[model samples]
Target: MSAAREMLCDTARAVFAEAAEAGMAPVEAAGFDLLLVPEADGGFGGDWGDANAVLRIAGVAVPDLPVAERILSGLGDAPKTLHAAATVGLMAGAMGQALALSIEHVNTRQQFGRPLGKFQAVQQSLAVLACEVAAVDAAAAAMAARLDAAGLDAEAADFEIAAAKLRANRAVGIVTAVAHQVHGAIGFTREYDLHRVTIPLMRWRGLHGNDAYWAERLGRQVAGFGGRGLWETLTARAE
Candidate 1:
């Protein structure tokens, strides 16, 4: 991460920590809605990279809050795909949290006079959880990069948004399952923090775009591009 982005994320974490206790009121008072506004317009003049980083923190800290909606409201009007992009970031964070909890539970929970992490089956499940988290993180990062390159135009970043959200949506099932499996029945308890992120992840998968919704839309987009044109467009976009 760039020094600037590291600082931005730190600030986001602090703000979200406050929001955890006080609710969205602190978030509004902090002016996160102006995060994407232009500097010339007396705002932060930030881009999608900044938004994704901040949203990641919000996802981990305030998963139930409307932070994505608040950030998008800064634009006044934006393409629906932008919500998908924002969701990828949130999903990445939530998946990461799930993985962390799973690892901790496996390391601490005893079975057959040993930690669950010592067992091969538990290790394999944790591995799957980690892989899913990494994939979602990569998708979120790539989507933010593409969105920034496109000047935050949701239409221009539509393909990336769809692809990232779809991958995240698919990962949600595996990640959540592995997490709960590793934690056993304790994970499902209403008093446990595991549900904090897992539930939101489930909700988010269907929020901006469901798996089938994105798959069909992405298929249509690729069909429009054709094989050769698809390769050219993808390569050019990477540049």
Candidate 2:
């Protein structure tokens, strides 16, 4: 990441952390909505990569704000919700926060006179969760990059976006399950912040498009391409 993008993400994380701690409503953080807007429109002139950064941070923070939606829409006249890129970004952020929380818990919480993290079972589970989270994040980033590069190439962008959303949705189920399993009963409690992230992930997975929807769309697209053309179609760059 560029120094400027890193700084922007840091600021967003801080702002979101404060809001989540304070139990405040998820209001738009100052200047966040402008990140994806064009400079000609008096906004930040950032690309999808920048917006993905903000969305990931927002997911980690677990704030109630529509940061992902705003960034995806560029605060334009378009409908604010159900943007695939933003939804994937939000899921990635949630997965990240959940992984962080699970690791902290395992390292601190004790069982059999030792930290839970010391147990092989717990370590294995956490490792799996970590992998899932990392995969989701990578998929989201790839989708954002594809969107940025493809621009008006709907076919190229749609394939990637669908794949990314499908990956994210599947990851959410695994990540949330492992997170709650590691946290045990406490993860289900209202007082714990883990719910803040996991719940939103569940909700966001259904938005934009769920796993089944994306899977079907992707399958149809590939099948329609026929066996002979599939490889070329998948490998072709956006025009």
Best candidate (score: lDDT): 1
- Number of colliding residue pairs in each model: 0, 0
User: Which digits, one per residue and each the tens of the lDDT, describe model 1 over residues 1-239?
Assistant: 88888988988898899999998998898888999999999888888989998998888899989999999998997678888888888989889889888888888888889999999988888888898899988888888889888788788888888889999999999999989988889999999999999999999989977999999999999999999999998898778
- Please identify model 2 stretches exceeding 4 Å from their true place: 18-29, 73-82, 152-155, 237-239
Each candidate: what lDDT?
Answer: 0.90, 0.78
Error of 2 at 86 (Å): 0.3
TM-score list, all predictions:
0.96, 0.87
C-alpha displacement of 9 in model 2, angstroms?
A: 1.1
- Could you tell me how far off, in angstroms, the CA of residue 69 lies in candidate 1 after the best superposition? 0.9
RMSD, one per candidate, in order: 1.2, 2.8
| lDDT minimum window of 10 residues, candidate 2 | 73-82
The candidate that wins on TM-score is 1
Error of 1 at 131 (Å): 1.5
